[model samples]
Target: MTVLTGEMLIGFSAVRGQAGEQRAFDPATNAEIPAPVFGLGDEAEVERAATLATKAFDAYRTLPLARRAAFLEAIASKLLEIGDALIARAHEETGLPRARLQGELGRTVGQLRLFANEVREGHFLRATIDSALPERTPLPRADLRLMKLPLGPVAVFGASNFPLAFSVAGGDTASALAAGAPVIVKAHGAHLGTSELAGRAIQLAAQETGMPDGTFSLLFGAGRKIGEALVAHPAIKAVGFTGSRQGGLALVRVANARPEPIPVYAEMSSINPVFMLPDALRNRAEAIGRDFADSLTLGAGQFCTNPGLVLAIDGPELQRFLIAASLALVAKQPQTMLTQGIHAAWQDGTRALDALEGVQKIAQGEPVKAQCNAAQAALYVTDAKRFLADGALQDEVFGPASVLVRAKDFSELLEIAERFEGQLTATLQLDSADHDDARALLTVLERKAGRILVNGFPTGVEVSHAMVHGGPFPSTSNAMYTSVGSTAIDRFLRPVCYQDLPDALQHDALKRGNPLALWRRVDGVPLQA
Candidate 1:
């Protein structure tokens, strides 16, 4: 077992926090881990971290792009160095299997390397130039240059579901650092041990790369006070969050209420709806049913992109698919969720679904003997009219449960799609014969979701430039930004334009002669020099 030191990391220094103590629990066993109660952070610590980050922002943001890239690479290297210990601690703290933790660790580091490459590429700057038009018929134009710059310090809240890939040193931190902004993380209480381990790696990386001391910091607290304090701090210019809709909205409100408002990119709730076209359902109902069960039950259905709602046209084919899906769900055994609170919430959600009018519980997964905090898969069905009438049906269940809505015809199915709130992903399971129906549905789905898939599940989100792990409104506070991939750096950046500045006074990427050899839009034409 790795030695546990429950302390707050402010810059390169570890301080014993004065804000109470808390212990981690093993959800699989429903027992608290022995010894090493983690220290919680308080308002003072939040102020200190934010102040230090504000001080470091100027130096850290102005570092040459290559040096910043190296800093990200260094963090990745340090994480790899402690990979074994991280996996073990994560498994113990999260009740997630060793294999899952290993994969998540890989994703965590892979993203860091990807961001390092993005920093080196320098295209994220979005450099543009318009030379002086002194010979214009009406009036002369000033030399203008535009590019993105960092938005000061950022506050990243660790996610409970993903201890590595979405926790400390996760996408938010990686992208913010890649965009030349300092980061201060509010560690998730559910995975304090994992956060500590990852935080140490970041500190070491910053030190080794000669980055500013306050470039990164990690604070711990189980309550909302610390999070609220961090967000309310004037130094935090932006926020990155992934959690329940209620929590995300609360943070957004706090950030807005600050004397100087800031952007809060919160990846909140989403059901990630899937539609089954008629021909496809008739052709491979059983296979699609089986696949749906597998995807819904994956990770005990703790994924943000879990297919919580499925829409299909009512017919004999739909009945066949439901039967196959129910059987597959019934055979599944209960799996442990991340924490007791999460397990309790899952139970509450499923119970509410069962009690809703016009909703029928079709089947439930087998229960494991003496297993604590286990989530049993459940399947439910209701008509499209009833579903559309009841807003409660659209709420995310956040577990191994899915509701299948049976529409009377293609028109009703499209109506259901139109009624849906913003979603992270919307999937269409269609066959060649269903192309016309799919084409009709495409426009509405494009407006409703950030990503639309054909014949695929939404549970597995790929980390790449093309990925958009975001959606409109409640799905995410701002749909224009993504929480994953290289483009995520855009969230922590804001465009700035310089007018009539001398070459020596302008940024290298915007200066004449292209000192940085960057690609930019010069006088409305793309150029590289």
Candidate 2:
């Protein structure tokens, strides 16, 4: 077992925090794991981290793209070097299966490499140039150049659900660093041990790559004081977060209240509704039910894209689907959740639904004895009208549970779709015959979700250029930005246009010789040199 010092990393130094001692818990055993005591960071430490990050941003952002890319690759390599020990600590802290944590670790490193490739490609800079048109008929146009630049130091809030993939050196940190911004992470309390290990890997990578000293830092906080202080600090320019709606909104409020408000790209909440078209539901109701059950129970319904709401028209086919789904759910055994607080919250959400009028508890999975927190799978049924009337039905339960809504007709289904708040994804299970209805529903769904799936579930999100892991307000703070894929780097970047500047003062990307051999828009036309 690797011993942890639990000190906060600020620049190249590890300082003992003043917020007091905290420990990681084994959710599977419901016991405090015998681990090193972690120091909770306070306001003063946040100031130190913020100031260092701000100072480092200048030189770090000006480094060649290749060097920046190399830094990211080095971080990925270091993470892999700490492989087994990191995975074990993550498993103990999150109560996630070893296989699952292993897979997440792969994703975490894979994304870092992906970002490196994206940086070297150079297109992300969006360089453009329009030469002066002094010979034009009436007036002359001055030479103009444009490109995106980093948004200074960024603050990333770690997520509890994905200890490895969304914590310390996760997507936010990778993307921000790739965009040439310094990063200050507020580590999630649930996995401080895991976070400390990853932070050390990043520190080693920074040192090995000869990057700026304050390029990265990790802070611990048992409560919101540290996070609040970091976000409100003047040195911090932007924020990236993934958590519950309440937490995201709170950060948004803090950012908005800052002396110079900054953008907060938060992946907050989503029920991720799945719509079953009549033709498909009628043709393979049983199969769809079984598959849906599997997705709902996978990871104990901890995924942000979990199918928490299911929609279908009322009929015999719908009845068959519900019956099959209930049967599949009942056979599943209760599984451990991430924490005791999460399990207790899940129970409260389920109990609230069970007590609501016109909502029927279709079935619940078999109970299992566990040393710690566990959640039993559950399925509920309710009419579309009743569901639309009661706003609580649409709220996410954050566990292995889902609500199936039966609409009277296709029109009612459309109305139900319109009632949905913003979502990360809205899936459609359709066949050839359901094309027209699918088209109609799609028109409405386009405004309600970031990603629309055809004949598939949303649990598995592909990390690629085409993926959109963000949505309108409530789902995320900014729908225009994503927290996944190559484009995620855009969140930490801003465009700057230079007008009539001398060649000597211009950036190399916009220089006369086209030194970087980048793709740019020249004189209102596309140019690749």
Candidate 3:
């Protein structure tokens, strides 16, 4: 057993909570780092942390937004300063490249900064005051103010693949902290070491910025008990999770079944299917094939946004494109997946695809040893009618695998796209010059996905203001909020409506006089004056 010493165990309060624990390994070397086991947290501890966070929220929420911004800035700086080491450890644990790790680190820091800027501007709080109409024709209207407030403490379940950007100091933690809610991060088992490192960076930032100590807590344990304890805990007002549909749904059911059910923003897995139209397939089948091959194989296809499914109308052009794509994928050696469980899941998925009726394996990947037990990218194809009949075909396989759906005609292709459930992204490969049916397809697809792409793959998720990284149902737990973007802060907050109140009784942002100088539009006119 490789012992974890140094900063790894520091600040982490070890409790007797191991139920079904396993050793996390360095994927590159397949060496055990430490036996990470965590079970249910003590009920008393859960309540205590909740109480502390609630008590802290009253004052913390009232703190100057500038001070809050400073805290976020401090976290961003700490992450950047230790970014190289963090990325190295991440690559060691995840088997991702330095370039990929570097990019994820940038995303993490960029997310922090985005939220910081959002809070600093104070527009996200959405302060609105409908002034009193003391006298009217029938009845008098009273002064009413509405603003968004933090929903007490939040429980964040870190994801396995993105150990940095989606774990510990990931978007959920950063957004929750910025929303004035204390956070308790449930670390991902596969990346516990990385989670701990990021946790310390967060703690250091908190202390340096003088944020409340109980405002953040990092707990580690194994099994479903810890997760059940966290979600079922009454103190946890909302949940943020990024994982499989099974795991995410469990949390949602727990929260929903609670006495006072809370929101669970679970961005469960998706196929992120890409559709190739006849015109585009005929014109640039080879180029699109290369692009899809790269996106599907990138990160060993660990990304939730991985284009696991590709749909196209059946023709010589479609056959040529798919053959070329599968060849490109087969030429690439198998890369390490995020974890053993993920590798197993991917293999199982491959087996299932192989077993499907009318499904034929067009390509299979050969093994290579850069990291842990690896699997190569595989491509499978089936007719659209069969695919539409089998709902299981829509599920995410979670590795370097892509399934091609061959449609008999353009109408069949549209029907397939319409039947797709909620997705993180949906792509349409059409010539820029082709607009009639493609435009109509875009309208239907818009209802099914958060992001729409044209002539591109869906694997690369850009962290930006314009990005909307969530969709309906299984694509995400909530469609109203985004997991990435300036808007992620919305998940951590709830609206508070105030009726005719005295000056002191009103919130500072909604006082008798507008004092925060917050961005406001009054009666369809800018308040710039």
Candidate 4:
């Protein structure tokens, strides 16, 4: 067994933090994992990590694209090599099922390989050549060529829920590294052992692939002070964060307050809403209701894209749907949440919902006997008038809890959709008969959410090129980029236009022979050269 020594991976060195110590706690047993006590870093460690990343920036970004892609693939291979030990550690730490951790490990490595392929393709560079027009009738134009460049060192904050897929070697780390930015990850407090293992995998890959020292570093820290210090550091040109709205906003504020403000791609709070059109409700209410219940409780509804709100017309069909949904929810067995803090937050949120005047509890899952951080699924119902009136009703409960809204008619449904602040995903269940109504709601939903779906739930986010796992405002800091796809690389890249440079002086992408072989837009026309 490879023993874990709770320490920070600062470049090529593993150094213990001096500020404090933390141990991973098993939410299922309500006990701490005793062997490895992680030492937490403070502002001093932050400075050292950031400085090393700065030292490594230029060499890392200018490496050959093939080597970069190979480096990513090496990391993926190393993770798969870690195998069962990784899954066991994650399961023990998170209280999630062993099967789920196994699946997430696959996802984490899959992301690395995907970004690896992305690097090989070189399309993300967006190389363009607007040739000089020396013989133009009017004024002659200057020779201009453009391609994207890395934004220097980045700070990634590991998330609590998807420890593998959104943590140390997760999408944020993978995408930023793919874009040639040195990454410094602040390991999430809940899963310190898990972070250490994955960070070691990355460190090994970097060294074996001959990547520059400080290309990656993982830190263990407590509270916002250390995290804020990373965001506020001068060397960190950008940040990628996944957490609560308050936490994300805090980093955003720090980044903004910096002398040279940088972009913070933060995936925050979202109560992904689902809509059931009248015809669909009339036809398959029971089926839709059952599936909704399953999605609501999947992974204890810890997914950021979990369907937290449902909308439908208030009629006999809707009532039928509610009955089916309530019965399905009531039959579900309670499951353990990610942490004690999350379990407590869920309790507080559900209790607060219970106190609301117009909202009514429709159903509760089978009670947990003595399981430590277990959460019983909850379902609530309220009218559209109440849902729209009380902004408190829209707050995300962050667990296996959902609110169903009864809209009087199509107009009221549209009103509720328009009222949504922002969402990661919005879904619609409809038949051909409801096409017109669905069309009317489409325009509003497009503006309100990043991804839209038909006749399906939003719990499973696809990690593909075209898929979008982001949204406006509270859902994500920037509505322009995605957090879980090929386009995610764009968040860490900035376009640079070189003008009137000699062919020998130009980078490979902008050279006259097109050495990189990237698809180039020449004089506004795209060509494969």
Best by lDDT: 4
* Displacement of the residue 89 alpha carbon in candidate 4, Å: 0.4
What are the candidates' C-alpha RMSDs? 1.1, 1.1, 2.9, 0.8
* Candidate 3 TM-score to native: 0.93
Question: What is candidate 3's lDDT per residue for 260-332, written digit by digit as tens?
Answer: 9999999997899898887898899988998899898888889889999998888898878977887787788
Encode model 1's per-residue lDDT on 344-384: one tens digit a residue: 89989998998998999998999767889998899999999
Error at 355, model 4, angstroms: 0.3
Q: After superposition, how far is residue 18 of candidate 4 from its true place, in Å?
A: 1.0
Worst ten in a row by lDDT for model 2: 363-372
**Model 3 misplaced stretches (Cα beyond 4 Å):** 1-23, 34-48, 368-371, 523-529
Please give the lDDT score for candidate 2. Answer: 0.91
- Pairs in steric clash, model 2: none
Q: Candidate 1, which ten residues in sequence have the lowest lDDT sum?
A: 1-10
Predicted structure 2: clash tally:
0
- Local accuracy by lDDT, each model: 0.92, 0.91, 0.81, 0.93
Question: For residue 421, what is the lDDT in candidate 1?
Answer: 94
lDDT of 4 by residue, 435-516 (tens): 9999999999999999999999999878899989899989999999999989999999999999999889998988989888
Off by over 4 Å in 4: none
Per-model TM against the reference: 0.98, 0.98, 0.93, 0.99
